[model samples]
Target: MTTGSTYTLQEINALSHDDFVQALSPLFEGPPWIVAETWSSRPFRSLDYLHASLCAVMYAAPLEQQVALIRSHPDLVGRAALAGTLSPSSTHEQSAAGLDRLSDEEIAAFSRYNQAYRERFGFPFVICARENKKESILAGFEQRLHNSPGQEIMLALGEVAKICLLRLRDLIRS
Candidate 1:
């Protein structure tokens, strides 16, 4: 995410819709519209309320929209991670999980699972990698493979929400 000033809720509320979206869209992975929608209900009482409202918009989204939102996320140790092209937040999360230190065999395993997950689910495998280790993430990939499409979609969205919460917490603290 791009660094900028810490914003008061009032300051957030005062921005134009485009400006607000520009400021906060990094918290989510897609176009700025969702955050733009959340902007209308502004003057948030707390950071929690702001995050909740942003999620409210996501929760109300249709199934396809939700899927698109999930698809916006990068795969764990996929091309973006390998090439150092991941967003700052994503790079940090993956590094926190020690993905940046993977051995060759580990990278091979991760790539295999990533491709399989994409084949089955039509999107990257999403997880809140900030607090996870490589083993848990690999285990998650194997376990989640058996889930039905609807379940996987919800699970991915939940992971995405976790990512958003961490981002929000950081932003507010900054």
Candidate 2:
């Protein structure tokens, strides 16, 4: 779909399931199944309503669904497909502060952290790339990995909300 004008509430609501899912593709780079539940409804009255409702639903989602959502986030250090679709400021933040641009020693440390995190959580480490710096992201990865499954799941959901909020704001602004 064209990424030109901001979609009206009506226009957004009228989108087909596939289109609606496509519209949200930039938010999390996971399987369409991760978003299928959200797309099951439509007719949002406004962007705020949509965002709020989505946040509620996401927070209330089952653990399996939450895991899917968390795993959907793009890798912190890689050729992320959604990188270009993110808001320019967010993209700039990632470029200026991402682990991908870290020094050799930092990259090595991140790799170890990434492996340990995945081993602990059984999923990729997640962070709200917009407001985080490399150091903070790494710290979060380390801290969150120490959480119990229940705690880590909740933390991941919160990060998902932050990510969705950023994407929703960008969608309306675009």
Best candidate (score: TM-score): 1
Candidate 2 per-residue C-alpha lDDT over 2-50 given as tens digits, one digit per residue, 9 for 90 to 100 = 2444666777788888888777655554665545557766777777778
* Whole-model alpha-carbon lDDT for candidate 2: 0.69
Residue 2 lDDT, candidate 1, scale 0-100? 36
Give the runs in model 2 whose Cα sits over 4 Å from its true position.
1-5, 78-93
lDDT of 1 by residue, 47-158 (tens): 8899889888998999989999989999999999999999888998999999999999999999999999999989999999996999999999999999988999999988
For each candidate, what is the lDDT? 0.88, 0.69
What's the distance in Å from true for residue 115, model 2? Answer: 0.7
- Candidate 1 residue pairs in clash (backbone atoms < 3 Å): none
Clash count for each candidate, listed in order shown: 0, 0
Model 2 lowest lDDT segment of ten: 81-90
TM-score of each: 0.94, 0.78
Number of colliding residue pairs in model 2: 0
